[model samples]
Target: MKLMHVDASPKGAKSNSRMLSGQFVEMLRERIPALSVDYLDLAQDPPPHVSGDFARAIYTPEEERTPQMRALLEPSDAMCRRVLAADALLFAMPMYNWSMPSSFKAFLDLIVRGGVTYIAGPDGYAGQLARHKVLFLTTRGADLRDGSPFAGMDALTPALTHGFGFIGVRDPWFVDAQPLQFAQPEERAAGLARAQAELAMVADRWAADVMSEAA
Candidate 1:
């Protein structure tokens, strides 16, 4: 199976989320020896924001579009094709001002196309990219889990879930290392340990499932 791993942290190697994701990849690699991974660091290479020309290319018929229109949409088309090609996607991101990083959002804008990824059906909207799985590895400086005092303030995961679901991911699961800034050393250590253990379970299960299906 193929996995697309996206890192949206601007801090690069210093990012805790990045470290966790790297560990996840290493552990998963042991389970699925033949698994192929394509990594994208959005902080280093972010997609362009949606523009008027991109809008025109998407709205215009493919054959009728000019070279300029094609050029405008080329990057977006490539990004979408990568997602479509992958069997599963894994995202590692940190919270930024109660939401995702702007680089990740920009990447989404370049990929989410109208007729290419979705269309208006006679009945209702339909998603072209379906039956895919998504895993979200996230870190937060503050507490925002289900029972935290600031539970209602988490605009990150909800927004991401909606955005990814809109593009046709059927199952999206999240494992978080929370309260990074607020936790004591022991608490932080425990949280990281828990997150890594959960990741191990997820990876082992997914690898077994894929192998069984292929068999």
Candidate 2:
């Protein structure tokens, strides 16, 4: 199996979400020895936003696209191709103002193309890609769980879940490193500890499942 691991945080190694995702990937590798992993670090090289010409080119028939249009469309095409090639996707994103980083949003725009990830058909909409498993790891500065003051304020999770679902990914696993901006050191420590424990649990579950399937 091939797994596409995408890290969208600009903090590099200091990113909590990246650490969580790395741990999960390690677990997957441990259980599924034959699995191949591809990593995409958006912070190092952010994808360009889609331009008007690119949109026009994608909507226009292939045979009629001008040279300028073709150039504009090439990057998005390549991004979508990479996404289509993967069997599973792992996104490590940090919540920025309750939403995903702009870099990650730009990457999403490049991949969600017509005739590539999804298509409009007689049935309304259909996803061209067959992959269904997605694992999302996020870090938030403030708590946003159910019934909390910030409840329903998690814009990134739902947005990403819907976006991936639009492209045929339905089985999504979400893990969060929450409330990083606690007023007390102990609160921050507690949050990090909880997140670590959750990561360990998720990794163990994933490992067990992979081994079971292999056996």
Candidate 3:
């Protein structure tokens, strides 16, 4: 099985999302010994923001694109290729200002190409990546769960869902560790534990599916 693991946290060792996602990846590795993982650290090598040249370049027919347009499209094309090649994708990020980090959004911008990742037809848009599954492992400083003061404030979840769904991923899974920064020590521990438990469950199910398919 091939998995693309993306880390958007700039905090390195101090990032909860990174830790949880890494552990989950390791869990999958344990279950699927031959699993191939392609890692992308957005903090270290982030995609450039989309520019006017890029917009024109994607629309331009490949055969007709100028050298400048091809150069401008290279990063986005590379990212799209990576996404297309992966059987599954795992995103590890910390929520920033009620949503995904800027770097992660930038990464999305590069990969969500029309002809590459999706097709726009008269019926609207059809995503090309329906064969791939996705998992988002996120950490938040605020309590955004049901009945909490920050309830429904999480724009990140829906954004991620629709963004990737636009390109064909369906029913992506999320494991969110929330309120870690402001919560009491025990509460933070509980949240982390909860996320870990969820991760284990998800990993088991995904690994089983992979093994079953292989058999």
Candidate 4:
């Protein structure tokens, strides 16, 4: 199977999402020895924001697309094609101001192309590219657990889910690495330990599921 792994953290080596994503990729490799993985680091080369020309390219039919319009849309088309070719997607997102980073948002804007990923149909907007699974790993500095005063859910999760689902990715898994900020060293360590343990459990479950499916 082919997996597209996207690293959205700008912190480089210091990113918790990067660390966790590395572990997850390693675990996936162990589970599927022949798995093909493609890594895309958004922080290194972020896609440009959508422009008027790009918008025109998306709305215009292929027969009517001008050379200038196609040039403006080529990057986004390539990005969306990569996503469409993959069987699964792994997103390593770090929480920035209770949402996704600008790099991730930029990537999203590129992939959600009109007519390619979704279309304006009689029944409203319909997602045309909807045949993949996604694993979203998010790292946050503070707790957002249910019922806590600071427990507001990150907007990124819902936004991404809806966007991807609109184009056909319905099975989405979320792995949250949270509460990295703390007053004491001990508290920070404890939180990290908990996240590590949870990661292990998730890996085990994924391995078992893959094995069962293979059988």
Indicate which candidate wins on lDDT. 3
- As a TM-score, model 3 comes out at 0.96
Whichever of 2 and 3 has more lDDT, that candidate is 3
User: Which candidate number has the best TM-score?
Assistant: 3
lDDT of 2 at 202: 69
* TM-score to true structure, per model: 0.94, 0.90, 0.96, 0.89
Query: Ranking by lDDT, best first?
Result: 3, 1, 2, 4
lDDT of each: 0.85, 0.82, 0.91, 0.81
TM-score, prediction 1 = 0.94
> Where is model 2 poorest over a 10-residue stretch in terms of lDDT?
126-135
lDDT of 2 by residue, 63-164 (tens): 888898878888888888888888778888889988999999999988888777998889977886655457788888888878779987888888988887
Give the per-residue lDDT digits (tens) of candidate 1, residues 1-215. 89999999988778999999999999889999888999999988977776777777888988999999988788888888998888888999998888888888888777677777776779776776676778998898877878989899988888888887777766688988887778788878888888899999999888988889889
Model 4 Cα displacement at 83 (Å)?
0.6
Scored by lDDT, model 2 comes in at 0.82
Cα displacement (angstroms), candidate 4, residue 201, comes to 4.1
Candidate 2 stretches greater than 4 Å from native: 208-215
lDDT of 1: 0.85
Off by over 4 Å in 3: none
Q: Candidate 3, 132: how far from true, in Å?
A: 0.8
